[model samples]
Target: AADRVYLLAHGKVEKVGEGPYGAETVLEVLADGAYFGDQALVDGDATWSYTARAATACTVLVLTRQDVLNLAERAGSLRGHLDALASIPEQRTNKYGEAAIELSAGHVGEAVVPHTFVDYELSPREYELSVAQTVLKVHSRVADLY
Candidate 1:
Protein backbone atom coordinates (compact mmCIF):
# COMPACT_ATOMS: atom_id res chain seq x y z
CA ALA A 1 0.00 0.00 0.00
CA ALA A 2 1.19 3.50 -0.74
CA ASP A 3 0.60 4.88 2.74
CA ARG A 4 3.47 7.35 2.64
CA VAL A 5 3.34 10.54 0.66
CA TYR A 6 6.55 11.81 -0.85
CA LEU A 7 7.46 15.45 -1.22
CA LEU A 8 9.88 15.81 -4.06
CA ALA A 9 12.75 17.87 -2.74
CA HIS A 10 15.07 17.53 -5.72
CA GLY A 11 15.09 16.18 -9.28
CA LYS A 12 12.01 14.69 -10.95
CA VAL A 13 9.68 11.68 -10.78
CA GLU A 14 7.26 10.31 -13.32
CA LYS A 15 4.04 8.80 -12.00
CA VAL A 16 3.03 5.86 -14.19
CA GLY A 17 -0.65 4.94 -14.24
CA GLU A 18 -2.03 1.57 -15.26
CA GLY A 19 -4.52 1.79 -18.06
CA PRO A 20 -7.64 -0.39 -18.40
CA TYR A 21 -5.84 -2.52 -20.98
CA GLY A 22 -2.72 -2.99 -18.88
CA ALA A 23 -0.94 -0.21 -20.70
CA GLU A 24 1.27 2.29 -18.94
CA THR A 25 0.06 5.84 -18.77
CA VAL A 26 2.57 8.61 -18.30
CA LEU A 27 1.07 10.75 -15.58
CA GLU A 28 2.44 14.22 -15.00
CA VAL A 29 6.13 14.46 -14.25
CA LEU A 30 6.55 15.79 -10.73
CA ALA A 31 9.13 18.45 -9.91
CA ASP A 32 10.54 19.82 -6.70
CA GLY A 33 7.96 20.56 -3.95
CA ALA A 34 5.37 18.39 -5.67
CA TYR A 35 3.34 16.15 -3.35
CA PHE A 36 2.28 12.62 -4.25
CA GLY A 37 0.27 9.85 -2.55
CA ASP A 38 -2.26 12.29 -1.13
CA GLN A 39 -5.23 10.32 -2.51
CA ALA A 40 -4.65 7.55 0.01
CA LEU A 41 -4.35 9.99 2.90
CA VAL A 42 -7.27 12.11 1.80
CA ASP A 43 -9.69 9.37 0.71
CA GLY A 44 -8.71 6.91 3.47
CA ASP A 45 -7.62 4.30 0.96
CA ALA A 46 -4.15 2.81 1.17
CA THR A 47 -4.03 0.66 -1.94
CA TRP A 48 -1.32 1.52 -4.44
CA SER A 49 -3.24 2.67 -7.49
CA TYR A 50 -0.21 3.66 -9.58
CA THR A 51 3.53 3.39 -9.81
CA ALA A 52 6.25 5.99 -9.40
CA ARG A 53 9.53 5.78 -11.29
CA ALA A 54 12.41 8.16 -11.00
CA ALA A 55 12.86 10.20 -14.13
CA THR A 56 16.21 11.26 -12.82
CA ALA A 57 18.18 11.04 -9.60
CA CYS A 58 15.93 12.54 -6.92
CA THR A 59 15.59 13.35 -3.24
CA VAL A 60 12.27 13.08 -1.41
CA LEU A 61 10.79 13.58 2.04
CA VAL A 62 8.44 10.77 3.03
CA LEU A 63 5.55 11.63 5.33
CA THR A 64 3.25 8.92 6.62
CA ARG A 65 -0.39 9.53 7.38
CA GLN A 66 0.34 8.95 11.03
CA ASP A 67 3.03 11.59 10.88
CA VAL A 68 0.51 14.10 9.58
CA LEU A 69 -2.07 13.13 12.17
CA ASN A 70 0.51 13.46 14.91
CA LEU A 71 1.50 16.91 13.71
CA ALA A 72 -2.14 17.97 13.61
CA GLU A 73 -2.67 16.58 17.08
CA ARG A 74 0.32 18.44 18.46
CA ALA A 75 -0.92 21.76 17.13
CA GLY A 76 -4.49 22.84 17.69
CA SER A 77 -4.18 25.57 15.04
CA LEU A 78 -3.07 23.01 12.46
CA ARG A 79 -6.17 20.91 13.13
CA GLY A 80 -8.41 23.84 12.35
CA HIS A 81 -6.45 24.68 9.21
CA LEU A 82 -6.55 21.10 8.00
CA ASP A 83 -10.29 20.87 8.58
CA ALA A 84 -10.92 23.99 6.55
CA LEU A 85 -8.74 22.79 3.68
CA ALA A 86 -10.30 19.32 3.60
CA SER A 87 -13.80 20.74 3.34
CA ILE A 88 -13.03 22.26 -0.05
CA PRO A 89 -13.12 19.82 -2.96
CA GLU A 90 -10.45 21.63 -4.90
CA GLN A 91 -10.29 18.99 -7.61
CA ARG A 92 -13.55 18.61 -9.47
CA THR A 93 -14.76 15.73 -11.60
CA ASN A 94 -17.76 15.14 -13.81
CA LYS A 95 -20.05 12.10 -13.95
CA TYR A 96 -17.57 10.54 -16.37
CA GLY A 97 -14.93 10.81 -13.65
CA GLU A 98 -12.51 12.99 -15.56
CA ALA A 99 -10.61 15.83 -13.88
CA ALA A 100 -12.59 19.00 -14.57
CA ILE A 101 -11.13 21.37 -12.05
CA GLU A 102 -11.38 24.87 -13.45
CA LEU A 103 -8.11 26.49 -14.40
CA SER A 104 -9.47 29.71 -12.88
CA ALA A 105 -10.00 29.03 -9.20
CA GLY A 106 -13.53 29.49 -7.90
CA HIS A 107 -16.49 27.41 -6.71
CA VAL A 108 -20.20 27.88 -6.39
CA GLY A 109 -21.16 30.58 -3.83
CA GLU A 110 -17.47 31.55 -3.56
CA ALA A 111 -15.75 34.49 -5.19
CA VAL A 112 -12.23 33.73 -6.37
CA VAL A 113 -10.28 35.94 -8.72
CA PRO A 114 -8.38 34.32 -11.55
CA HIS A 115 -4.64 34.68 -11.23
CA THR A 116 -2.31 35.73 -14.00
CA PHE A 117 1.41 35.31 -13.92
CA VAL A 118 4.72 36.11 -15.56
CA ASP A 119 7.69 33.77 -15.76
CA TYR A 120 9.02 33.30 -12.25
CA GLU A 121 11.77 31.07 -10.85
CA LEU A 122 14.07 31.07 -7.87
CA SER A 123 17.51 30.38 -9.31
CA PRO A 124 15.92 27.81 -11.61
CA ARG A 125 18.11 24.91 -12.49
CA GLU A 126 19.04 24.32 -16.07
CA TYR A 127 19.07 20.84 -17.54
CA GLU A 128 21.24 20.02 -20.47
CA LEU A 129 19.96 16.65 -21.70
CA SER A 130 18.38 16.04 -18.32
CA VAL A 131 21.56 16.62 -16.35
CA ALA A 132 21.81 19.01 -13.38
CA GLN A 133 23.18 19.24 -9.87
CA THR A 134 20.84 18.29 -7.00
CA VAL A 135 20.96 18.90 -3.27
CA LEU A 136 20.87 16.18 -0.61
CA LYS A 137 20.32 16.50 3.13
CA VAL A 138 23.17 14.10 3.82
CA HIS A 139 26.56 14.77 2.31
CA SER A 140 27.62 11.84 0.13
CA ARG A 141 28.75 10.91 -3.34
CA VAL A 142 25.90 10.53 -5.84
CA ALA A 143 26.15 8.65 -9.08
CA ASP A 144 27.16 10.84 -12.00
CA LEU A 145 25.13 8.77 -14.41
CA TYR A 146 22.93 11.67 -15.39
Candidate 2:
Protein backbone atom coordinates (compact mmCIF):
# COMPACT_ATOMS: atom_id res chain seq x y z
CA ALA A 1 0.00 0.00 0.00
CA ALA A 2 2.53 2.52 -1.11
CA ASP A 3 0.37 4.60 -3.44
CA ARG A 4 0.03 8.25 -2.46
CA VAL A 5 -1.54 11.45 -3.82
CA TYR A 6 1.17 13.91 -4.76
CA LEU A 7 1.68 17.18 -6.54
CA LEU A 8 2.99 16.46 -10.04
CA ALA A 9 3.76 19.84 -11.60
CA HIS A 10 3.73 23.61 -11.26
CA GLY A 11 0.73 23.46 -8.96
CA LYS A 12 0.15 23.98 -5.27
CA VAL A 13 -1.50 21.24 -3.22
CA GLU A 14 -3.00 21.30 0.23
CA LYS A 15 -3.95 18.70 2.80
CA VAL A 16 -6.31 19.24 5.67
CA GLY A 17 -5.98 17.14 8.77
CA GLU A 18 -9.66 17.79 9.44
CA GLY A 19 -12.75 18.73 7.45
CA PRO A 20 -13.52 22.19 6.00
CA TYR A 21 -14.17 24.87 8.64
CA GLY A 22 -11.52 22.97 10.53
CA ALA A 23 -7.78 23.57 10.38
CA GLU A 24 -6.17 24.10 6.99
CA THR A 25 -3.07 21.95 6.80
CA VAL A 26 -1.19 22.83 3.64
CA LEU A 27 0.86 20.09 2.12
CA GLU A 28 4.43 21.24 2.29
CA VAL A 29 6.07 22.13 -1.04
CA LEU A 30 6.96 18.71 -2.39
CA ALA A 31 8.94 17.95 -5.54
CA ASP A 32 7.06 16.80 -8.63
CA GLY A 33 5.93 13.15 -8.35
CA ALA A 34 6.93 13.13 -4.72
CA TYR A 35 4.62 11.45 -2.22
CA PHE A 36 1.83 12.79 -0.10
CA GLY A 37 -0.66 10.69 1.87
CA ASP A 38 1.79 7.81 1.81
CA GLN A 39 1.10 6.83 5.39
CA ALA A 40 -2.52 5.93 4.61
CA LEU A 41 -1.55 3.69 1.71
CA VAL A 42 1.37 2.17 3.60
CA ASP A 43 -0.79 1.30 6.60
CA GLY A 44 -3.51 -0.02 4.26
CA ASP A 45 -6.09 1.84 6.27
CA ALA A 46 -9.47 2.78 4.88
CA THR A 47 -10.61 6.38 4.42
CA TRP A 48 -7.99 9.06 3.97
CA SER A 49 -7.27 10.77 7.24
CA TYR A 50 -6.41 13.94 5.36
CA THR A 51 -7.93 15.87 2.48
CA ALA A 52 -5.64 16.86 -0.44
CA ARG A 53 -6.12 19.33 -3.28
CA ALA A 54 -4.10 20.98 -6.01
CA ALA A 55 -4.22 24.75 -5.92
CA THR A 56 -3.29 24.82 -9.62
CA ALA A 57 -4.05 22.55 -12.56
CA CYS A 58 -1.74 19.54 -12.77
CA THR A 59 -1.82 15.89 -13.69
CA VAL A 60 -2.24 13.55 -10.76
CA LEU A 61 -1.83 9.80 -10.69
CA VAL A 62 -3.69 7.69 -8.20
CA LEU A 63 -2.09 4.38 -7.24
CA THR A 64 -3.90 1.77 -5.23
CA ARG A 65 -2.54 -0.53 -2.55
CA GLN A 66 -3.09 -3.51 -4.83
CA ASP A 67 -1.25 -1.70 -7.62
CA VAL A 68 1.78 -1.07 -5.43
CA LEU A 69 1.73 -4.64 -4.08
CA ASN A 70 1.72 -5.93 -7.63
CA LEU A 71 4.40 -3.51 -8.75
CA ALA A 72 6.82 -4.70 -6.06
CA GLU A 73 7.12 -7.99 -7.93
CA ARG A 74 8.54 -6.42 -11.07
CA ALA A 75 12.05 -5.00 -11.38
CA GLY A 76 12.86 -1.44 -12.63
CA SER A 77 9.41 -0.27 -11.61
CA LEU A 78 7.34 0.89 -8.66
CA ARG A 79 7.72 -2.56 -7.14
CA GLY A 80 11.33 -1.81 -6.31
CA HIS A 81 10.15 1.21 -4.37
CA LEU A 82 7.67 -0.90 -2.44
CA ASP A 83 10.25 -3.54 -1.66
CA ALA A 84 12.68 -0.93 -0.46
CA LEU A 85 10.04 0.91 1.55
CA ALA A 86 8.58 -2.19 3.18
CA SER A 87 11.89 -3.80 4.01
CA ILE A 88 12.72 -4.03 7.71
CA PRO A 89 16.06 -2.99 9.14
CA GLU A 90 16.74 -6.48 10.43
CA GLN A 91 16.23 -7.92 6.97
CA ARG A 92 18.99 -5.60 5.74
CA THR A 93 22.53 -6.96 5.81
CA ASN A 94 25.10 -5.35 8.08
CA LYS A 95 27.87 -3.03 6.80
CA TYR A 96 29.78 -6.23 6.10
CA GLY A 97 26.70 -7.25 4.09
CA GLU A 98 25.87 -10.06 6.43
CA ALA A 99 22.85 -11.13 8.44
CA ALA A 100 23.80 -10.67 12.05
CA ILE A 101 22.11 -11.02 15.39
CA GLU A 102 22.49 -7.53 16.82
CA LEU A 103 20.81 -7.86 20.18
CA SER A 104 19.90 -10.46 22.80
CA ALA A 105 18.26 -10.41 26.23
CA GLY A 106 19.96 -11.99 29.20
CA HIS A 107 16.69 -13.59 30.31
CA VAL A 108 17.57 -16.20 27.73
CA GLY A 109 20.87 -16.61 29.65
CA GLU A 110 22.82 -15.25 26.71
CA ALA A 111 25.39 -12.50 26.41
CA VAL A 112 24.16 -10.49 23.47
CA VAL A 113 27.01 -8.03 23.17
CA PRO A 114 29.06 -8.13 20.00
CA HIS A 115 32.19 -8.37 22.15
CA THR A 116 32.58 -11.25 24.56
CA PHE A 117 33.81 -10.64 28.09
CA VAL A 118 35.75 -13.07 30.23
CA ASP A 119 35.26 -13.02 34.02
CA TYR A 120 32.23 -10.78 33.67
CA GLU A 121 29.17 -11.14 35.90
CA LEU A 122 25.67 -10.71 34.38
CA SER A 123 23.76 -8.37 36.65
CA PRO A 124 20.34 -7.44 35.17
CA ARG A 125 21.16 -3.74 35.36
CA GLU A 126 24.61 -4.21 33.84
CA TYR A 127 23.32 -6.28 30.96
CA GLU A 128 20.57 -3.85 30.11
CA LEU A 129 22.85 -0.86 30.50
CA SER A 130 25.48 -2.36 28.26
CA VAL A 131 23.02 -2.94 25.45
CA ALA A 132 21.58 0.55 25.80
CA GLN A 133 25.00 2.14 25.88
CA THR A 134 26.15 0.25 22.84
CA VAL A 135 23.03 1.19 20.91
CA LEU A 136 23.39 4.84 21.90
CA LYS A 137 27.02 4.91 20.84
CA VAL A 138 26.28 3.35 17.46
CA HIS A 139 23.34 5.67 16.85
CA SER A 140 25.30 8.74 17.89
CA ARG A 141 28.16 7.89 15.60
CA VAL A 142 25.81 7.27 12.70
CA ALA A 143 23.81 10.42 13.39
CA ASP A 144 26.94 12.54 13.31
CA LEU A 145 27.43 11.72 9.63
CA TYR A 146 24.21 13.52 8.74
When superposed on Cα atoms, how far off is each prediction in RMSD? 15.7, 14.9
Candidate 1: what lDDT? 0.72
lDDT of 1 by residue, 1-146 (tens): 76777989999999888665778887679988887987545545668756899999999999897788788899998778767757865555665346554444334554565554434567996656756677654212224433
TM-score of each: 0.56, 0.41
Give the worst 10-residue stretch by lDDT in candidate 2. 125-134
The number of residue pairs in model 2 that clash at the backbone is: 2
For residues 48-143, what per-residue lDDT tens digits would candidate 2 score against the true structure? Answer: 655666667666667666665666666566666655655634344555344555564454454546753333336633223434433334444347
Candidate 2 Cα misplacement greater than 4 A, ranges: 1-7, 18-22, 76-84, 87-146
Which predicted model would earn the best lDDT?
A: 1
| Structural RMSD, model 2 | 14.9
Q: Give stretches of model 1 more than 4 Å off.
A: 20-22, 88-146
